[model samples]
Target: MHLLIAWCGFVGAWLLFAGPIYQAATELEEEGFERDAFSAQIDTVEVPERPSPWWWLLPPVGYVLQRRRQTEYRRRIMAVMTQDQLERMVAFANTATGWLFVAGGAFFIALKETWELAEVYELSVLLFVLAVVVMFALCALHTIVRLRGTHQMLARSGTARNRDSMTDEPPATSDA
Candidate 1:
């Protein structure tokens, strides 16, 4: 009973705040990255591929390992990737956040039930399913709110990159 209440509270807080928390953290991390990136020699720029769907199947352990890989990949990419590429990857990860929550919650419940750490297995599963639904809804809505700004930034950087290559002289206007 007490465990269930605690779990519910955690889920509620996550639904209400996780998206903004993720966005803020990523934004802050980007600041330092931008600084170091300017000085670094760029021999190669390797864009990261999205992970395969097999991740969720491994349940609890897979999530941790996948996250570690994600961090490593992000760090590596930030060292050389363009602003548009970095932000686009971040946005894609943001969109996938809800599944991480769902996998984590469900895996916890499964582990607890297997070890007899908690009772009421059926109810726990049901609650977690509902929580997953709520998480998906909240994250989707948050993504919608944030997508435009991220996309605009990407567009700006892309245009800037293209403009940087052009000759300084302005394009001649056609005579009317």
Candidate 2:
């Protein structure tokens, strides 16, 4: 999923912004505009004096925010846990949840030219929003399940006063 989002987002950015610039420049040249002079003027523009690539920061920013949110949410769900178990849950949630963004972004870019620009934009926005909502819902569900399991494990351990009470014991008992 992360790969999908990254690949799509990169392609979308290139198509939506870079493609238009090239297209417009090509159009101008074809219409007998002073192509060489215009190219020279653009080339003379100082890159350092221009604005930075602030937009590039968005993906990581979004990823960080989403990861943080998922971590906090999982923490809430797995409220009853040892420190190590909680940390593992947080790590899993952070890595897994972040991939959805990448996948959705890739899907957005792939469909950009297949639809109108407005439609593409709307679809991309909707996809991202849906990704976030779904991730949240899934995370919440996972947390609930994990917490319930933990509760059951603790309850069983607490009530096991004799070897006869081990009827529900399983072969594996890892916290995960």
Candidate 3:
């Protein structure tokens, strides 16, 4: 019963986090389609046709079709998004993933303590470590990429400033 409750809670939390993101992405995709942003590339895309209902009898075939559809939809959405928008979406996703990991770790830790299970304790520790690693890795990657772009921008601006100053008239000297 406790395990079932925990599983339900996990699903609820996932829905809470994922629902808004999914809605936003869907809206964005619809807007993109309305603007004909995907029209030009539509021909180039290998969109999988909707599978027949009979195919659902074969679970593997159904799963593959579903995956293909999702992949194609994601591709279209990504193609429509600008770089800044994509980066923001990615950052949001990373934050959500980090939080989920932290929550999962906490859940496992609680479960271990409540049940006094050695295996659960080990699993809790593993989840905690995974949470830390994932959070750290995502943060590091974001910082590195952002810093690289900033450094390049600053370098270019500095070079331009130096060039402009060099081309300008020299300051006049004051005679005593």
Best TM-score among the predictions, by candidate number: 3
Q: Per-residue lDDT for 1-176 in model 1, tens only? A: 86776566555555445545445445544544444444352435454565666877878767876787788765875766777757765665665575466545654544443333224343566665665566556655676666667778999999998888674677889999
Sum up the clashes in candidate 3. 0
What lDDT does each candidate get? 0.58, 0.50, 0.58
Candidate 2 residues lying further than 4 Å off, grouped into runs, are 1-123, 162-176
TM-score for candidate 3, residues paired by index = 0.39
1-176, model 3: which lDDT tens digit per residue?
75666555544544443444444443443433333543554555656677787878999999888888888878876886778666766766666566566645554544433333323344576665564455445444554565567669989999999999999998889897
TM-score of 2: 0.25
Question: What's each prediction's TM-score?
Answer: 0.28, 0.25, 0.39
Query: Between which residue pairs do clashes occur in model 1?
Result: none
Candidate 2 lDDT (Cα, 0 to 1):
0.50
What number of clashing residue pairs does each candidate have, in the order they appear? 0, 5, 0
lDDT of 2 by residue, 1-176 (tens): 65555556544643453333333333333444343544554465433222235634797866666666666654444454546655654555554455445444544554443234334345576765554445345534654565567668878877775554667566786798
RMSD for each model, in Å, please? 13.1, 24.5, 14.6
* Worst-scoring 10-residue span by lDDT in model 1: 111-120
- Model 3 lDDT-worst window of ten: 112-121
Q: lDDT at 60 for candidate 1?
A: 74
Which regions in candidate 1 have their CA more than 4 angstroms from the true location? 1-12, 19-22, 25-124, 149-176
